[model samples]
Target: MKVNKDLTATASANLILDELYTNTGSSSFNLEHDFFYGGAELEIWTMANQAGILLTEDTDYTLSDIDDTLTNQASRNVYKAVTIDNVTYQSDDIYFSYQACADFVDADDRYMVTREDGQYWDLNSSGGFDLVVSDDITFKDQYLASAIPLSESGTTGLEGF
Candidate 1:
């Protein structure tokens, strides 16, 4: 199996849970995808222009979640942002960044599982590297499809790296 490692900081600013017309006054929202696991600090701008006023945890919003299990993670993806008094966001006006994972694949077509010590957080913390892969996984001995063509620099000059 191949894992697609993506540390992309996709700044999603699509919907506004609160507005003058709709007036949902929503207190929370979810990222575009689940299984976010963990990531960098969250980022939120009140204006489309990204004015100097950047929102933060506790002061402007609150974020929480415990990605301890596969089934428990999706619910943890919910992000709760406090309302800014009368400053209702009537347009595209919220953004954030975090580390995420779509962890079914691995880099070298090698198979991996989150079943280390029989826990989900093992993949992120603990001895994740020590996880067990069943014998079903077949190794691809050759990393390169063809022989490497050296510049002959190694023999020509020992100084060449």
Candidate 2:
């Protein structure tokens, strides 16, 4: 899929997820229980405008008398910024951030069950499982705004100045 990298970070993530589901039988796949446990990682990357360029093709043309054709098409060099996000990560921060969950109808004490040797066990059993829960999720209506400006240069081309 072709996309303008600088503006489609979130869209890229969604596309990755969609592709996974599609390839693995979308109708039978469960995102949380299947894909997450199946070891799927989401990663994102951002780059400055200096790293790329955008080319704009000109539409203006002149008529040629000899061949009876249009000629002298105009075009402009437009700098482009690219941002890439994928399932594979290039940084450590994104590599370690992941979460998984499961659903059980039993009581909290018996949420998790396991078997060891010849013994059946529950999470709350002696030396069974250690559960930790946190409620530190932050929700924001809008993102923090910055005053960065887009500028073009003769040597380095377009960038945030």
Candidate 3:
């Protein structure tokens, strides 16, 4: 008889390793982070040295949760698709770098709060968002890194990496 076991770890790891190398010539990886930086800002390397060409989003690999701008990213996914040449096999190691809310106590990481209609709040003494509420962001989209592609023009989000 087989006995099922309850998971001691219920949530996904803040920093996880997903091995993409395979003998079947294809692989898929899942990244479930609430504050995932998103695909447009994500940088994925298919090689160990990270010196060769970078894979293009939607063309080489498909990133899930492309619809809404909601805060919940538990449904997000990243799939390294199969190519004509089986691109995944070219390298024995795959690397990726991204920012996410890994920890809540770390001040370097941003915080999330609940919002509802008919609610109001004011910025804290430092002009930062309040834990209870926040005013509508009046800053231009160009000034926001999350809204704009921080990479150089004509580059496919692979500039710094």
The sequence of per-residue lDDT tens digits that candidate 2 reaches over residues 11-123 is 33323321211122112212321112111222211222212221111211111111111111111111111112222222212111112122111223231322223232222
TM-score for candidate 3 = 0.32
Per-candidate local distance difference test: 0.35, 0.21, 0.35
Error of 1 at 158 (Å): 61
lDDT of 1 by residue, 30-106 (tens): 34333343323345565344454566555555555434454244433423223332334423355444434434233
lDDT of 3 at 155: 26
TM-score of each: 0.33, 0.15, 0.32
- Candidate 2 accuracy as lDDT: 0.21
* Candidate 2 Cα outliers beyond 4 Å, as residue runs: 1-23, 31-98, 102-161
> lDDT at 130 for candidate 3?
47
Pull out the clashing pairs in model 2: 53-80, 54-78, 54-79, 54-80
What ordering of candidates by TM-score runs from best to worst?
1, 3, 2
Off by over 4 Å in 3: 1-27, 32-35, 65-91, 101-161
Per-candidate Cα RMSD to the true structure, in Å, reads: 17.1, 26.3, 17.9
lDDT of 2 at 55: 16
| Candidate closer to the true structure by lDDT (higher is better), 1 or 2 | 1
